[model samples]
Target: MPSIRLLVLACVIPLALGFKELKHVSYTQLPTSISSAGAELFQGIEKGTADAAAYDWVNHVLYVVGRTSHLMHVIDLTDPANPVRLFIHQFTRGEGFPNDIDICGGEIAVALSANREVNEGHVRFYHTYTRGSGATDVVLDGYVTVGPYPKSIRYTDDCQSVIVANEGIPGKDEFNTFVNPEGSVTIIHNERTGNPAVQTVDFRKYNTDDAAAWPYRVPSKYIPIRPTVAEGTEPEDVVVSSDGRTAWVTLLENDAIAEISITAQGLGLVNNAVRLPRKDWASKKVDTSDQDGGTHRRMYAGLKSLRQPGKIARLRIDNKDFLITADQGGVTSFTNAKHGFTWTDATTGKSLAANIDNPELKANANDVGYLGRLQVSSLEGKLFDGKNAELVMFGGRGISIWDSKNFVSPMFDSEGSIEEYTDSFFHDIFNCDYIASTATTKSPDTNKDTTSYRQGDFVSGLDVADDNGTVYMVVGMYGTGSLILYEVDTSAKVPIPMFQNIVRTGGVEDTWSTLYTNKKLGDLHISDLGIITSDQSPVDRPLLWVVGAGSGSVSIYNITESLPVIPGR
Candidate 1:
């Protein structure tokens, strides 16, 4: 299999193509800062805002979503670097906030979260190609209802079904209380019009231990008392298995992932709850920040964080299944005295020892009152003893690989690699924190590493592509605003993924382009990544379509696939 995805490309090479690192080819920023294609359409737009994205290779069209703006901007990708926006459409619903969009088979679908206040969501379909009624672009089809706060929307590999990660985050009340709606994954079967079939898999049962962890949600003072809800798992994103029959959903708050099989009957009861591992600050070193008024380096024994994965991608190597995730672990900003002192709240009356007994109870003393704050006890089976443990912050800030089986076994991690890589080629200001082109920094802008490409940088999105014997991992760094490519060694029992090259999309001054309406496209927080296989792409090699939610821009890059990869992995 010499990169089966690209067949027609004639080539003669050695016995093996050992891609030690991903090759830096080229990239096209959506707006050249000088892009005046759609200046008349979107005027007064001056912020970094872009979120989920999907591509229609057949039409050479890219669909990017604006989560807060409730708009979907269409771009023609025939010209990779200088993409032209064909049109922009806003959601019809009064409160429709588009979360994710996917090119389902030939039909386009968009997931809409009506409003946080009203936990109602919907999935609307559209014909990829149509005509009449004086319309130049495609038209919307019918619509189907889904769960609340629907975040990640994806089509099964077969393209016959779709999965929506409905994160049931109950909007906070005036008093900062939450509703804690049951998180679920909605599967739309046979996406036909006559009878739309939808199944919502409630994750309450997977809580496993009845009393093991804190309730998914607790009541506020307004309630007579706090009631325990078993739905502790909140689904963030879903990635279908290699075969497309099984869907993997990430539980951000609970540090877990659920595997559910799809069939005509319904979503099989989740028999697998793979708990993510902890990024022990004890064993490994990480770059907390270069701006801590300290040396830019890795630290050890800092506290451990529940490897609460954000988005997950399923990968297959040598016929074995594996998973990768952007270890953007969720940590409460307002924790007990350890985080910071708070004299302005009611909970300040009690000390950690005198008042704190259950991790489910409010761990943050700022009595505006936060329920479901995680604690050390939850680490018993995963990390260590619950008593007197160190609480810390985490995000792995990179990527991690794990066996896709029920047991959580990590194979590798890219901690601090991206930050280290960015320091090598660009300015020092492009550290772990995202750099906006127009935004000046107070941190020392000197001392850049000029040798290594393997800088441990922060990643936001990932897309995978493979060839004969190599795996290519395309990573989007929200921190330094660059698209990174990597090669994974699939020969090992567990695949080993490593850094290769960094291609800045925009953001950095005088790097990707000189055109900066406000910020470079690199400054965009690359959120969604989708690959264009040779089957649909017109170019000589496959391509990648990436969108950043922050810059409200898109990047179309021609990719040479010879290695394995995945999006937001």
Candidate 2:
């Protein structure tokens, strides 16, 4: 065991200076056979390897699922310093790819998407504990068919039910026409029983005239050319309440959160979809261009961003429920250039600059030194009044904390702080591409460039860990391959997120090939994060497990705390 460091000034410090250190313990690279099978399918695309991870505290095991590999690699975590691979469970060819996983009450449930995105997917169940040394030790329990593209899954706190979020992304058919399935939520009751009752709740009820009057940005109303009312609203992730009576689903594209009522009668009712507030870049500074000289951040006059949260987690503070979201923005880019019905919700700042009438905003958008390469949404702030037009971007570019009671706006947002920290600390690789760019690559200073810093620290994964009431947040950046730790103070009226530390996990080396060849300690493109506390860990220390999709590796870290005090105090 490593020596534990204690903080001398525990109470006198301002708490903002109090930091948590993440010590890299060990890492294991998944077999190439598991990650290389479907490599040819997504040639130029940055595909995920170890997508999601679920820890079984009872067995001291970690189960990691590969998104494109179609396999689950199980590892024994009895020794935190040295992890051992136990076995691998391979899903059949047509069974589908595992998207997300969760463990509860000696049972493991995996959300799987079909071979085709438009087809119906399923939730497969298995035993978490291995009876023997073979792969068959993990017995197959059963499976329940779910909606299209089941993106995320979670087991209720009670372990009696399982909730799944069906994304229902649109896909082209044999005739090349788009087939959009209605997004839905699947709830499984008596999951441990032989015959489980399944209830798939859809958003069909909200497709009416009454729902049309809602305040949120409905995709159908904004685009009007693609999916209908129900089909346009896709559920990205689902988190359940402590009592298991309510579930909040993140509608990423719709810029809203759907509250669902879970009942004993096997019915999940869609109570309401509450729209989230947008972030005004005019007040919050953002790095709008990769062509700008070395992470240049400024407040744009007309730039606003939607908080299109990709993943969500619930945290309880002072007996009140707060929802934390990783606002990873997304855009719909389906186009048929031949049919002339080509419509995309996102466009470059240069394109919007050509259409808008604002002279100052137009000049900024036209100049590569400004916002020409930035990607903004075309759905909102398009005022054709010749005087003003607000440029609405796609994502919030940071994490947001929202009051669960009131979903109207966020209690606190790490606006520009994440970018500021990354730029100051990681200037050499600031805003570098996770897949394409190397660690030696630097953001262009003066010349007009687009690829290097186009996508700033794509905040993709986040998890909240509590160490004896001291709350900490671990934010995973997909673009730069970094992890940021923050000490969250929620006792006051509004929670204050204090910066602790930032560690670069993936981009320590020059290239992915060299990093992989050398068996690098950190991997790229962090897709998901899981935390095992001291009480839950077999090694009796808190462990942070990071799943890197770009490099096909799982990096483990041992967490410890330190308190820095003011000189007088």
lDDT (Cα, tens digit) per residue for candidate 1, span 1-569: 22321210111111235433233333433431222353533222224246787887667777777766666777776666567667666665564778888886678988888655336689888876422233456677778888877888888777778889888654543455545456778988778554767888776653433444532322111222222343335688888875667888887766677788877543545656666666665544444332234334544342445566786777787778888887765532222332122111111111232333434332331121111121222223223334323333435666777777744446666645555455445544445343345233311133222111122344668777664444667777764557776656566555665555566645333432232344443435567876666666756466777776655566666665354322220
- Which pairs clash in the backbone of model 2? 293-445
Best by lDDT: 2
Task: State candidate 2's TM-score.
Answer: 0.88
In the range 1-569, model 2's lDDT, one tens digit per residue, is: 00100111122233544467677888888854444453322222245568999999988899999877777888888888899888788888688989999999889999999988888999999988663545544778899999999999999998999999999887765576668789899999996777888999988876754544654676554543545568888899989988888899999888888898999655788988888888887876788877676667789888888888888988876667788898887776665642225667777788778787778889988877787787777667765564338777787888888888897667777777777667666666666654355323432221212232244676888898776767778888876677877676656644566667677754344454555656662656788997787889887777889888876788888877765423220
- What are the lDDT scores of the predictions, listed in order? 0.56, 0.75
Weakest 10 consecutive residues of candidate 1 by summed lDDT:
5-14
Cα lDDT, model 1, residue 98 = 81
